[model samples]
Target: MAAANYFESKCFLFFLLASLVVDGIVAAAAVPKQQRLDRISSLPGQPPVAFSQFSGYVTVDETHGRALFYWLIEATSVAEKKPLVLWLNGGPGCSSVAYGASEEIGPFRINKTGSSLYLNKYSWNTEANILFLESPSGVGFSYTNTSSDLKDSGDNRTAQDALIFLIRWMSRFPAYKHREFYIAGESYAGHYVPQLAKKIHYYNKAHSNPIINLRGFMVGNAVTDNYYDSIGTVTYWWSHSMISDKTYKSIMKDCNFTEEKSSARCDDAVSYAINHEFGDIDQYSIYTPSCLALTNGSRQHMRVKNALLHRRVSGYDPCTENYAERYYNRPDVQKAMHANTTGIPYKWTACSDVLIKNWKDSENSMLPIYKELIAAGQRIWVFSGDTDSVVPVTATRFSLGHLNLHIKTPWYPWYSGNQVGGWTEVYEGLTFATVRGAGHEVPLYQPRRAFIIFRSFLKGEKLPKSKRISLQLSFN
Candidate 1:
């Protein structure tokens, strides 16, 4: 009788254990119902990773069938606990996937042949869940059924659509509905980030309780004030010796900084600088080599493709945009990533020429938006890559100078490793920093330092003031 009872208990224990295992598996496979269709199991040539990735379109306008595309790379560890970061690339027409994801901060960097993928050691996903958005209707895989939408794209519509994307996207991934969120981008994104932040700020205010918990925003080498950017860019060209003194003088005299549009003479002078004086050097990163595949005797490249200026050299691949273009256009890759299901006519390009040419409305200055958000006690950080001549550090400095915010923490050298990472100044409602030796895309040029800056920005902490290892956090 005793032996029989013991056998019964052991059998019961085994059954209970087996039931638990089955339950765990079921739960593990259970994804949000709305997100199930867009979940990416894996990408072609993507190395194995513990974290899951999701990419697909979110329809912002049902009437026009305008949908924006987003790729969400969950945090490396504890994604649920980490903050969600929305990254936008500014071309007024550029694909964030091509510039931000494949090249700058995303986890994967396309190989030279564009046939394989490799991990970016300094990917921003290491610290936060990074969401790369192909914003507006006409950039990358994001599209609009209404042909007029492309020609009508502007700052107002882009911000509205992006807000809608986030609202609907949060519903799809309810896990991140109330998570601390941030907006980040570079170049033209300088305009996008703050404008979107202002929208979210007001949106949250009107609602009693909002799902979008926007913490702050950061922009690198941003186009802040049109007046400052124009003047500052011309100054950068001459100061860096990229243009002759005569050309600089010509731009200053011909360009009316106060006007919404430049004079034809100003345009002529600027063109002369690009054509006669600038040579073939990459204006984005004056020090980096231009992508020969795109630049060699291509007038279209000189005019359209130069908007994003995606280039890198030395330790990084110079033809990253080409690789991204090839990899993203692959049928298998698109199918796996669940992109272009509508069979769009155009081949994927980095920046959309149609949208760029048709950009109808752009705010002359984001200073008013900055002041509004700052008054609301929003966290605002502006950073710049020192080596970029197009939207140079000087341009950002000139724009921010218009803010005239009181400094809290005086300028100081912030350390990443043994060397100085960059210099930072804490303001009453904002922070400004510069990444040393960094180009147009700071993360692509100095990933480690950029990551450090990112972490600091997120935590609302000043960068480490010392070289001592104890002061700085270890990052992968």
Candidate 2:
């Protein structure tokens, strides 16, 4: 009897081991090794770090050979448990890798000489998995087989291609399937972020079980309504003393904010604002020093062109983009990043002038979309850097005031590290905050404070309202 019992036990153990092996095999097969193939072992001049990073192209349109480039910086600790954040930089043509990753919120800061990278201690990845995508076909390392695609890119196509990229990317990195997700961007991405969110929202509704679990979105110093943005911008210039009162009045009187193109008188007035009123200062961050090294002619267009930049290649960078251009163009950097594999004709540029000049379509207003999403209970947040004259806090406030939502928490000073970081107000369906003394690129100027607000956003908590409480999180 004892021998028979022992034989049965041995058989059970054998079956258990076999089942485990089969399960492992099935799991491995289900998740592709493409993600592993795209992993970065180390970047040139990169310091040792504990986090994992992956970068490569996701082909969106096979016939056109159109692909979007993405860089995933996993969270510093317990990354799988943290939510994923998709970040975009707008110029309709800027590279997120240049602005978002290298300067604003990414893990590394390029040294002055572009020879090496140092860790960004206050990187957003500490709170969430940050995915930086260079969207449309012609931006950054992203490319297209057809030349026409670059010149013909528009708002609609940009949104559609981004959705496609995410669908395929999630499949390639199957671990991220159905993970809590959020979209965030600055400047023109006011349009991209919301439009993409709208697509994701409706797509999920159409399908029984969607792969992306999108929770909310955030935009900073965004371009919302052309009319409101224009009006508010001119007002900001005069109010902030960036332009003379005479120039301001001429712009206000002559420019029809509602029109697609400003009248000749308006253009001339605006030109005068650029040529005569403003000096050799960085218009984006009025209080900051301009990058004297990158200065050519006086920059024109305060709104949305190459002159108009969510493009962080200028202003208070201290010649940061010059360094970034050098670093990214290096052969070693490209190889390590798995970027510029095809060796496209042009060098890697921060913003593609071709796409910017010939952009096919744009939405005049995003207020309606904001209403729709807010009604659907989407968590929406808008923040501004008070020092950014380009898309100043005043411009955002004017645009958002049109929403007419009930104020949940009245405006109050929010504290970070025993100092007033900024002011914030919570609304029925949205939240608005400002960063004190920060510029167009908030993190580049005020990283620790940026982290605090970001952490609060992820947790669905309000910014700390008191210095005593702020002191607790100051060490972060």
The parts of candidate 1 lying over 4 Å away from their true place are 1-30, 296-315, 469-471
User: Tens-digit lDDT track for model 1 on 136-215?
Assistant: 89899999999999998989999999999999999888889889999999888888899999989989999999999998
Superposed on all Cα atoms, the candidates' RMSDs to the truth, in angstroms, are 2.9, 3.2
- How many pairs collide in each candidate, listed in order? 0, 0
Residues 115-174, model 2: lDDT tens digits:
999998889998899999998789888999899998899899999999999999999998
User: Pairs clashing in candidate 1?
Assistant: none
Total clashing pairs in model 1? 0
* Candidate maximizing lDDT: 2
* Pairs of residues clashing in candidate 2: none
